[model samples]
Target: GIIFFGSQMITRDWIFNEFGCKFSITIDILCTVVSNFQVIVYTVAALSVERYIDAKLSLTLNNKFRTIITITCIVLIWTMGLLMPLP
Candidate 1:
């Protein structure tokens, strides 16, 4: 996001050849998508860890179940992250 915004700001008063413009656009899209995916993954991981710690401290879930739940959450997180960027 920052990359794309900065590129736009920098190019506002400048002229780019066709190749340069295309390359800039491609980089912007790639950066945006990758950044979004990274943010989602980090957020999900933090939340998952917090939840797991809370459950562990409170003794609300057994170790095996907690492990299973954590794995499931991770899988879902990656799946959502991958699919959400398709649009």
Candidate 2:
């Protein structure tokens, strides 16, 4: 929903209509794409690795420790993506 607002603001013509600069839409598009890819791909990979570790340990996957691990994984995704080059 926040992205929807960003998309609208990105396309508005009034400022450019006055300033005579064309705003290409690719910036928003690339940001939208890379952000999703960054989050979803990393989260899924984390889940997969957690599942593997849980299976190897022969333990139920929904323990408090697992929850902590999942949150840490998501935080890692955000931190790592911050250091990565954005599209």
Tens-digit per-residue lDDT, 1-87, candidate 1: 344457668887435567766777786688568857775776777697867787678566677886786688777766666555444
**TM-scores for every candidate against the unseen true structure:** 0.51, 0.57
Per-residue lDDT tens digits for candidate 2, residues 6-64, read 55589853343322323334555566677778877888888788778977975555577
The worst-scoring run of ten residues by lDDT in candidate 1 lies at: 78-87
Candidate closest to the true structure, highest lDDT: 1
Our tally of clashes for model 2 stands at 0
Each candidate: RMSD: 8.8, 5.9
Model 2: per-residue Cα lDDT at residue 39: 75
Report the CA-based lDDT of candidate 1 relative to the real structure: 0.68
Q: Distance (Å) between predicted and true CA of 23, model 2? A: 4.6
